[model samples]
Target: MKKLFFVGILAALFVGTTNVSAMTEADLRKKFDETVTINGNKYAVSDGDKKLADDYLAKYEVSSDDCDYIAKKIDEAKAILTAEGQEDLTKLSESTKTKLKKLVSDVSANTSVKGTVTSGSVVILNSDGSTFAEVTSLVKQTGTERSNIAIIAGVAFVITLVGACLVVKQVKNSNN
Candidate 1:
């Protein structure tokens, strides 16, 4: 069953890439904490994710239709995450999963652009970077691949060290 599902996903991704090459660009930029109130609570957008969106879009000539399609896929990714209750990358509906794979393959096909597009806690890259939704689909697709995992891991370690050092500095300052 799992194999069948993965096969289906891989098919979707390839289909998306073929179709997405002609897409135009869209405005996906957003400020840190850009939000709308939901049930009297403010829901914020991640600044890093916006930067990812900007970087990817700038590198490619995405058509308006593809742009909208991607934007919609982002929402669907979130809904899948919510419905599956965290880190269950296999929970997307068949159609939604197909669309997501398409976006991944599309992004991956653009060899000129190499990096990740993250939003909130989502890793939006599939061809090179890490995205749970995309990984299962691409695992079987073979080619001389470029991976950003090491770079991302190193950067993450550095960021953690910097954060720790800053926290220590703050603690010392408070003591003094």
Candidate 2:
């Protein structure tokens, strides 16, 4: 009875906290309209762009080594968000891509895109475990910073598709 009561209480606490904390459309709109100040200049921040920073922030703590790097990336992110810069989204994407291409390798490189086939086929599954933060922090301290690449996720999904085909081949081989 005591155990059940404690479990119920814990469940209620978790549920109560998460339920009301979930943001609604109004809350998201308010967040979108928010401004963030950097280097004495205030810039409007989009909720989506902030989410990108937040994705990095999740893994980042305030560290002397990372403070400057993270801060710099945060600044770049602000530029991207501008909330709106030159009115050229394509230009923004290209610049970020150029800077990151040298520093960041393809994220899906280690993921198995190919498997061997004998009389039987082998199954290979490749998935990207790195979050955007890890990707941003990809070579940190050992620190190689990748300016966010807009097409990286799309590329990763395509790479994963090759592995997905391998899985199908394996399934067919096993059935035979």
Candidate 1 ranges with C-alpha deviation above 4 Å? 1-27, 31-45, 87-103, 106-176
How many backbone clashes are present in model 2?
A: 3
How many clashes show up per model?
6, 3
User: Across residues 89-147, which tens digit of lDDT does each residue of candidate 2 receive?
Assistant: 22335554343231112211221121111121111122243222211211235533443
Which pairs clash inside model 2? 139-143, 139-144, 140-143
Q: lDDT, candidate 1, residue 99?
A: 55
Model 2 TM-score, 2 decimals: 0.26
In model 2, which regions exceed 4 Å deviation? 1-44, 55-62, 72-85, 93-96, 100-129, 132-176
Q: Give lDDT per model, in order.
A: 0.41, 0.33
Global CA lDDT computed for model 1: 0.41
Candidate 1's TM-score reads: 0.31
